[model samples]
Target: MTQPQRDCVIAGGGPAGMMLGYLLARAGLAVTVVEKHADFFRDFRGDTVHPSTITLLAELGLREKFLALPVTQLCTLDAVVEGERMTLVDFGVLRAPDNFLVLAPQWDFLDFLAQEARTLPGFDLQMDTEAIGLLRAPLDQDAGREDAQGTDSAGDVLGLRVRSAGGDQQIHARLTVAADGRTSALREAAGLRAVESGVPIDVLWFSLPKPSEPPPATLAYVSSAGMVLTIDRGDTYQSGLIIKKGAFPAMQQTGITEFRTRLVAAAPVLAGVADTLTEWEQIKLLTVQINRLLRWHRPGFIAIGDAAHAMSPMFGVGVNYAIQDAVALANAITPQLRQGVVPERTLAGVQARRERPVKVMQAIQGRGHRVIARATVGQRVLSLGAVRLLRLGSPVLRRILARVVGVGLLPEHVRTPPGGSR
Candidate 1:
């Protein structure tokens, strides 16, 4: 069967893929986004939409609509370390209008983008379709040999072979983006190598009913028992219990009641719902990973977000970084895409612009992993130094930390034109 052709074909409908698709479509470039999932409903996905992301939404004039969705604004990041409550990062100091981390389910955010993208004449979204491999045109063919600059090029990628409920099909495009996430099949098929950083901890995520009254803005608890992070989700608290890496299986052998007991002991705040966790099936394991590709692009394709770099969940910046990647990609490629050719240099430029921030953020997350590993092994207590710094250092220190988490090292902005609203 003859495959439909588009200006760009994006694999995976996560933040990176969907946002890039929306931006390209808005720029008047035909784009098709393929998602393996039929719907964007998933438990325990990154729900923290950082200030950086909020800024991008505003740039596209979708801030009000995006904020209309049910979301909780986290203005201050507090934590219970060694039984003492300490304010670590204060988002209130940021000068932006929405100077706080917006906690909304990732699905709502993606759905919002998908709906907005549909308004553009050039946008096409195919749900329940998974990209299986690349559709490569022979390099010898003159039509297939053109580079991003319309010059002769090697390693030309033509499109994607995708599978859906209907069956297998092909999608041809001038450019293909691998934004399918950390375990991207396309990245692997392209033989891009990613350097992995060993993580010493894993997270067990679960949810409990929210307390009738407002909970503390604090999101983390570090005690002799272990480390726990909780985000207030309006009606419930989404929680992550940090356990030693590779220890979950052994911990599971001990039984669910003991696990529940340990959870209550670690964070007394969760005692109310401790008993609600009667079965092990209620918990989901998130195997923490930190890694980045040495190279983020090839002749016909480029990888963004977790496809290029997978971050540790320590700071909940994974989603934020992915969104940033989308913005950078759009800013760099939209003009070329509009011209009907995307140079290999342009693809490499996207990676060059975004790599530094990825490196810096991953280093911070790596240090966090080491700290958590030490606490899990009882090798160290919650650093009183961190508490001292926050206490003695004026609001300046808090603001600095907040800026780091809220906006990241170098944030990207929307550069593409905003299309008509639906």
Candidate 2:
């Protein structure tokens, strides 16, 4: 059986792929997104929704619907540095209305996008479907054909060869996109490799029930013992202890009691419920990484989000950045996709537009990793010099951090018109 060639076939149904699928379908382009996972529900996922993404929801007329889902709005990221508490990031400093960081489960966010996309006639999402390989065909062009025609049958990537419960099938399309995330099978199959930046921290993730009188939900505790990030998830607290890279095995030998003690030392507020972490089964190790591909595109294919750049869990901007990539790609490619084939230059332009922002964020995260690693080495991360600088430039610091964390480096708005082809 032959599948109808679509305007686009995205390899991963993640943040970038789903959003791009939604935007493209809204623009009247046929798109099929395949995800290996049967569902979006997963443990210990990034939960931060930045302010620019919040603005995007409003642009798509999805603000109310997205807000209706369970979410916590964080106006400030409070950090306790060397026993001194200070607000490291102030979302309040950003322009009103869009100001605030939203804490939402990554599953809910992905589900929301999938649901919205399905309503579009051109959108098709397939869960439990994995891209096993790429479909490539040498350019066979006619000189008289236009750019959107045979000219961009272009090179190599024709679509994706995927596998599901029904077995193997081919999704042939004008263009293919790899949004499969870090360790992406599609990216690897494309022979693309990301250049890795060494990260000093690895994180241990677990959740604890809220205490009767739990302290106010903040961002992190940066103490000499180690850094502990606590995310507010309504009734429970999603927390991660930042430890030295490849140190989980040694940390395990010290026993769970020692782990609890160390976590409590970093975040005193968690002292009440820290003892509840009795078994090692409850903890999961997330080896932190920051990496980006030297080339994010091939002839007839392109990569976005973690497929292009794997982000560290620093400011929790990974998901938002991925969505931003989708917006940029959709904005740049929709016109060509509507006509037919998305030209190679257009795909290259999308990568060019997004690469700088990804690099800048990764650099900041790398610096943050170094700063936080000091705590693991028994040194104060927030030295007096830094504290004084922050205090002296308090207003300036708030504005800068708010923009960097909540709004991002280069924010893209939805440009693809809705119901264009629908």
Candidate 3:
């Protein structure tokens, strides 16, 4: 049987793939997005939607509709470092109209995008389709062989070989995009290598019922017990307990009773509901990773978002970065895609445009990891002087921090044409 063809085949239907698919389809390109999961209901995914993303949605004329979904607005980030309460970032001071971050389940956000993309004429999203391998096309029949065996040859990725409920099949496309996230199968199949950094922390995520008198600000408490981050999730408070890398086994051995006590000591806000966690099954472990692919593109394939760079969950920038990548990809290749061809240069252009920001963010996350590791693993108390300095600093300093965390380093705009004919 003949395989189906498209202008672009995007492997993964997360933020990056879905946004890219929407932009391409809006510009009248036939886009097929394949997602391995049957649905987007997975828990513990990043839920912080930054201001940079909101601005892009506004430009696309979907901001109002997007914001209409059930979401909690977080206007500030406060942390209790060494028992000293200090405001770290204030989104209220940002110059942008939508200054605050939105706390909504990732599934709702993806579902909203999927619904919008479905309205377009040429967008096809395939759920339960797992991309297993790359379909490569030879570069030249008589190219000079580089290897001694003369078996190694240059080739371009033509599409993907995917497995679904029906059977395994091939998908042909003018361009193939690997947005399958940190453990990207397409990126691995294309032989792209990611340089990994030693992240000294991992997160244990769980949720508790919302308190009767909820705290006004999202809180990050760093104490002798451990570090804990709690975000208001309307009915429940989503929490992350940061522990030293490879400490989960010891934590498990310590048992749930001791774990609950440690959590309550770290963040007093959870004192009322921490007991709800009776077993290990209630918590999810997120192994933090900070890495980036040295080369984000190979021939006719391009890797974007977490597939290109896996970010640490320090500032909650993963989803925003992914969306930014989608916008960049759309801006760089929509015109070429309209011509029914995506040149290798275009794929390279996307990487060149987005790599610097990834490096900067990774560096910041690395520094943060070191700080947390010292406080948690080394048992050294964080200096209160930095907190005092931030509190005494000018409002401009707070705004700068806000722009860095809330809006990101280099924000991307929506350049692709809104719903229109080719």
Candidate 4:
């Protein structure tokens, strides 16, 4: 069957794609989103919405909705290093309104976005549709003669032929967005190469028993091996074990008690809650690869979110960055489209507008991963230095740390809003 042509088609209904759909549709562009999964699961994915992203959410008219969600406000990140506990960073220094990270489940956020997108005028959310390949007919000027005669003369994107439960269907759009995640099929089809540099730390996400009593804001225990991020989720605390790439399985096999012991050895204060630990089978381990695609846009297609850049889990900033990309892409191109510019030309504006922020985020994530990967001696120095520097509360240090927490003082290019795309 043939799907109606749209102004834009976004593959992968993750945060970025959904937000992009909302933005474009709000701008009166017919947009359709294809997702392989029929249902949004409760995956333990990104939950940290940095202060920078908070600011962006306000710009998108989503602050009130996002704030209404059950979220934990993470004001500061405390680091326990070599038995010394210190508030290594405080997000409070960022500008008013959005001064800290908002901790909420990505599933809840995406679901809210999906619900919101349904009410928009020009939006279509197609679930259980999988993109198999890019449908590009080698620019044949002769082939589009029929389309040229039609009211929509630009011929734009012919969209994608996707596999679905019913059968095969062709989704037509002026632009196709790839938000299909780190290993993106659309990006692969576009022949976009990913340039990656491995970070020193890999993260293992494991679920422990939900604490009877709630936890602190956010905990970062930096050790010679790596760091563990105790991210606060309203109902449960998500513990991310950042360790050497090869260390997770061995640690998992050591069983709960031993794992608890090791965790306590690194940060004794968390030992009290160790007994609540449950199964590790559901634990998801991700190799920290700080990678970026050399090209974000190719012809009628553009990749967003993890599809374009997959950053290390060191600072929990990837989701926020992806949301920023959605906003940038939408803001830069919608007005251009409204003014009758061709889709390809409008996408160029999107690419140009997004280039700086992508680079800035890549650079920051790279440096952060390096700090996480520093040797024991180096980590000790870094930990102690961070403690000492933080104590000063100097203007420069405040500004720098604010940037680290995604409250970057750089122009709008570098600042992403804090709320999830609501």
Better of 1 and 4 by TM-score: 1
Superior by TM-score: candidate 2 or candidate 4 = 2
Across 1-422, the per-residue lDDT of candidate 2 in tens digits comes to: 34899889998887889999999888888899999999998899899999999999999999989999998988988877777777878899788898999999999999999999999999999999889888887546652233432132334788999999998999999889999988888777666667899999899999998777976677788877889888899998899999888999998999999999888888888889998899999999998889998777776789999999999989899999999999999999887877786687898898889999999999999998899999887788877888878777877888899999899889999988886642
lDDT of 1: 0.85
Candidate 4: segments with Cα more than 4 A from true spot: 139-157, 210-215, 252-257, 339-345, 374-390, 393-396, 409-422
Tens digits of per-residue lDDT, candidate 4, 349-415, equal: 6666666666777787777766666632235526667656655654565457667656542334322
How many angstroms is residue 142 displaced in model 4 relative to the true structure, after the best TM-score fit?
14
Q: Which portions of model 3 show Cα errors greater than 4 Å?
A: 139-153, 378-381, 419-422
lDDT of 1 at 67: 90
Question: How high is the CA lDDT of each candidate model?
Answer: 0.85, 0.87, 0.86, 0.71
Evaluate residue 183 in candidate 2 and report its C-alpha lDDT on the 0 to 100 scale. Answer: 81
Q: Which stretches of candidate 2 lie over 4 Å from their true place?
A: 138-155
Residue pairs of candidate 4 with colliding backbone atoms: 52-416, 52-417, 53-416, 53-417, 53-418, 54-417, 54-418, 56-417
**Cα-based lDDT at residue 350, candidate 3:** 83
Which of candidates 2 and 3 is the stronger one according to TM-score? 3
Q: What lDDT does model 4 reach?
A: 0.71
Clashing pairs in 1: 148-342, 148-343
All candidates' TM-scores? 0.94, 0.94, 0.95, 0.85
- Write down the lDDT that model 2 would get: 0.87
What lDDT, from 0 to 1, does candidate 3 have? 0.86
Candidate 2 local lDDT, residue 397: 81
Per-candidate Cα RMSD to the true structure, in Å, reads 3.7, 4.1, 2.5, 6.1
